[model samples]
Target chain A: MKITIQVMVPPYSYEDLDTAIKIAEAALDKGHEVTIFLFSDSVLAVNKLVKPVKADRNIPEKLSQLIKEKGLRVEICGICMDYRGVNTDMIIEGSNPSGLPELAELIYTSDRFINLMA
Target chain B: MEKKVLFVAYQSPVGSVWPNEVFRTAFGMYGEDIEPAVLFLDEACVTVSKNTKPELLGLFPLTTCHRLIKRYGTPVYVVKEDLERYNVKEMEEIFNPQILSRVELSDFLHQFDLVIFM
Candidate 1:
C-alpha cells in the first residue's frame, strides 16, 4: 500500500514521531511505499537545531537518516513552521517546506493516509 | 483516484477552532470521493466525549463539528492513552467510540489511502 502520514502533534513529549518513524520503517521493511508530512507542532520534529540531550536519541537525526536511507519524502508545513519561527536553516536535511495546497494535493493523490497526532 | 483520508485531530476539540476548521476543509476538499475518518488523540479526544459541553463556548460550539462529521457517518476513533490521561475513558461507555491502541492504530494506518493531521 502507498501510505502518506501526517504528523501534527508535539514532537518531543509524545511518541507520535517515534511512531511515524517506526511505521515508515515497518512499511518499507514490508515492501510498502510510504510518505510523511509534518504539520502544526509536529513540524518541530524536523528542526535541526533541536538536538537530543544525553541519554536521548535525536529524533530529527534519526528521521533524516531514515529519509536518506529509505528515500522518504517529507513535506513540512510552511505556515506552521513560520508561525513557530522555524526557518529552512533549522529544518532537518532532506525535508522541504510545503504549504496547504501541496498537502491537499498529497491527500488527493495518495493511496493511503494516516494522521499520527499527539 | 478514490482514496481513503484519515483526519488526525491532535488539538483540544473544545478550546480551539482548529479541529472544526480542519474538518470543514477536509470535507470541502475531498467531498464524496474519499472516505474520511477522524481520529482524536491526546487532548483532542475531549471533543467526542459525551460530557463535553461546547454550548458554553457560545461561538461554534464544542461538539458541533463532531456531530456534523457523524452525520456523514464518519467514524471517530479516540486514542486510549489520551482518554486515560484526561480521566475520560468512560466516554467509551457512553459514546462508544472506537478506542485505538498502538497496534490498532498501526493497522488502521494500512487501511487508508491518505492520512491528514490537524
Candidate 2:
C-alpha cells in the first residue's frame, strides 16, 4: 500500500515530525511505500543549514538519511518554500521540490494519508 | 477506489490562514481520484454562515472554492452545536450540507481513510 504522510510544522517545532518518522519507519517495515509531503513551515525540514549540537538530535540529517536508506520519497511544497524563501539549492539532496498538483496525485494514489500538523 | 480525506476545521478564519488553506488544498486536489470533504467545527462554522465572504477580507478566494465545491459536488459537514455556538444561521453556497449532531459526527468521521485537522 502507498501511504502519504504530510508534515506541516517546522522540524523540532513539535513532536509531529518525529512521530511522522516513526510512523514511516513502521509503515516501511511492513512493506508499504511511503511518501513524505512537506508543506508550510515543515519545508524547513529539508534545509541543509539546520545545525544542532552534538547532544541534540540532528533532525534534518535524520530526514535525509531516511530518504537515502529507507527509499522514502520526500516532496517539499514549492509555494510554501517561496513563502519562507527556501530555494532548491538550500534543501537536502534527496528530496524533490513540488506543488499542490503533486499533493493531489499522492492523496489520490495513496491508500492512506496521515497529516502531521497542529 | 480513491482514498477518502476529511478536512476537520476547528479554527476561525479571523487573522488565520489555516481555514482557507484547507479550501485551497481541496480545490487543488478535487476532480482527481480523491474524495475530499470539509467538516466545519468549533469557530470554523462561522465561515460557512450565510453572506460572510472570507475572500473579501483578502483571505484565500473562497468564491473559487465555492465554485469547485458546487462543480464537483464535494461533501460538506457541520456540527449542529457548532452552528448554534457560532450563531451561524445557515451554511450557504453549499448544496445539501450534512448537519450532524456531535454523536452522529463522531461515528460518521471514521468512514474516511484520512483526517486532516486545522
Candidate 3:
C-alpha cells in the first residue's frame, strides 16, 4: 500500500516530527511504501546544518538514514524551505525539494494520506 | 455506505492556523452520503461562541462557522463544562450546537468510526 505522511510542524515545538518518523519506520518495516512530505516549520527537520543541542537523536541524520537504508521517500516543501531560509545546500542529501502540487498529487494517488500539522 | 466521522477541535480559532484549517476541512468533508460531525472541546468551544470575531484577527470569519453548520447540516457538539469554563454561552441561534455533558460527550465519541483531533 502507498502511504503518504505530511509533517507540518517544527521538531522542537512538539512531537509531530517524531511521530511521523516512527510511523514511517514502522510502515517501511511492514513492507509498505512510505513517503514523507515536510511542510511549514517541519522543513527544518531535514536541515543538515541544524543539530539539536540537547536531544539524543539527530533528526536530520535519522531521516537521511531512513531514505538511504529504509528506502523512505522524503520530500521537503519548496515554499516552506524558502520561508525558513533553507536551501538545497543545507538540506539533507537524500531528501528532495518539492512543492505542494507534487504533495497533492501524492495524496491523490496514495491509499492513505496522513497529515500531522501543528 | 455512509461512515460516521467526527472532527474534534480543541484549539481556539484565530489563535493559529490549525483551527481555521480544521473547520475548512470539515466544511469540505460534507457532501454526498457522508456522515460528518464536529465536537468542540476545551478552548475550541470559543469558536462557536456568539462573541468570537475571527475576522478581526485577520483569519477566517466566525460567521463562516454558522455557514458550516447550516450548509452541511453537520451536527455540532460542545462540552457544556468547557464552554462554562471559557465563559462562552451556547446560543442555538448563533452556534447551532447541541450541548453535551462530559459523559454524554464520551459516549457520543464512541459512536463514530473515525475521530480526528485538531
Candidate 4:
C-alpha cells in the first residue's frame, strides 16, 4: 500500500507524533510504501537544532534514519516551518520543503491516508 | 462494509474545544453508513461523566449525547485508569461506556480502520 501519514503535533508535547513515526516504520516493515508529511507543530519534529528531553524519543534523528536507512519519503510543510521560525538549515537532512499542493496530490494518490494529530 | 472510525477524545472540557467537536462530529455521522466508536481517554473521561453539563456554557447538552447513543447505538469506551484517577462517579447515565485498561485500550485502538484523536 502507498500510505501517507501526516503528523500535526509537536514531539515533546505528546506521544501521538512519535507514535505516527513508529506506525510509518511498521508499515514499511510490512512492505508498504510510506510517505510522511509534517504539518503545524509537527514541523518541529524535523528541526535538527531542537534538542528533546532525554526521556523523550529523538524525533529528528529518527526521522533522518527513516529517510536515509528505510528510504521513507518525508515532507515538511514550508508555511508551517516558516511560521515557527524554522529555517531550511534547521530541518532534518533529506526532508523536502513541501506546500499544500503536494499534500493534496498525496491525498489523491495514496492508497491509505492517515493523519496522526493530537 | 462501513468504514470503522474510532474517535479518541482525550481532551478535557476545561476551555478545550475537543469534547464539543468530537461529540458533534460523532453525532453528525450517526445516520451515515460509517461505524463510529468513541473512546474517552485521559481528561476526556469527564465528557461522558453524568455530572458534566456543558449546556451551562451554551455548549451542547449532555442529554443530546445520551440521545445520540440511544438512537444511533454508538459504542462508547473509556480508559479505566483515567476514569479511576479522576474519581468519576454516577457513571450509569453517561452512555454506559465500556471500560478498558491502558494496554487494553491500546489494543482496542488497532481494531478501527481510522483513528482520530481530539
Q: Write the per-residue lDDT of candidate 1 for residues A6-44, one digit (tens) a residue.
A: 887777788888899998998877877778888778889
Model 2, span B1-118: residue lDDT tens: 7777888778886666676777778767765777888887888777677666766776665566677677777677888988887788866856457788988976788998878886
Top of the candidates by lDDT? 2
Best of the two (2, 4) by TM-score: 2
Model 1 chain B: ten consecutive residues of lowest lDDT:
B88-97
Error of 4 at A7 (Å): 9.7
Candidate 2 docks with a DockQ of 0.66
**Candidate 3 — which pairs collide?**
none
Clashes of 3: 0
Indicate the TM-score of model 4: 0.52
Question: In order of the candidates, what TM-score does chain B achieve?
Answer: 0.78, 0.84, 0.86, 0.86
Which sections of candidate 3 miss by over 4 Å? A1-8, A35-40, A43-61, A64-118, B28-34, B57-60, B64-69, B90-95
Candidate 1 lDDT over residue span B1-118, tens digit each: 5667776767876777566656664554444456667788788888767777667777566455655655665677887888878878446333347878756888887797656666
Ranking by lDDT: 2, 4, 3, 1
Stronger candidate by lDDT (2 vs 4): 2
> Which prediction has more favorable TM-score, 1 or 3?
3
Best by DockQ: 2
Interface RMSD of each: 4.0, 1.6, 6.4, 8.1
Docking model 4 quality class: incorrect
Candidate 2: clashing residue pairs, number: 0
lDDT of 4 by residue, A15-112 (tens): 86678888999999999999998877788888888776789678889989999988899988887788799989888889999876676566556779
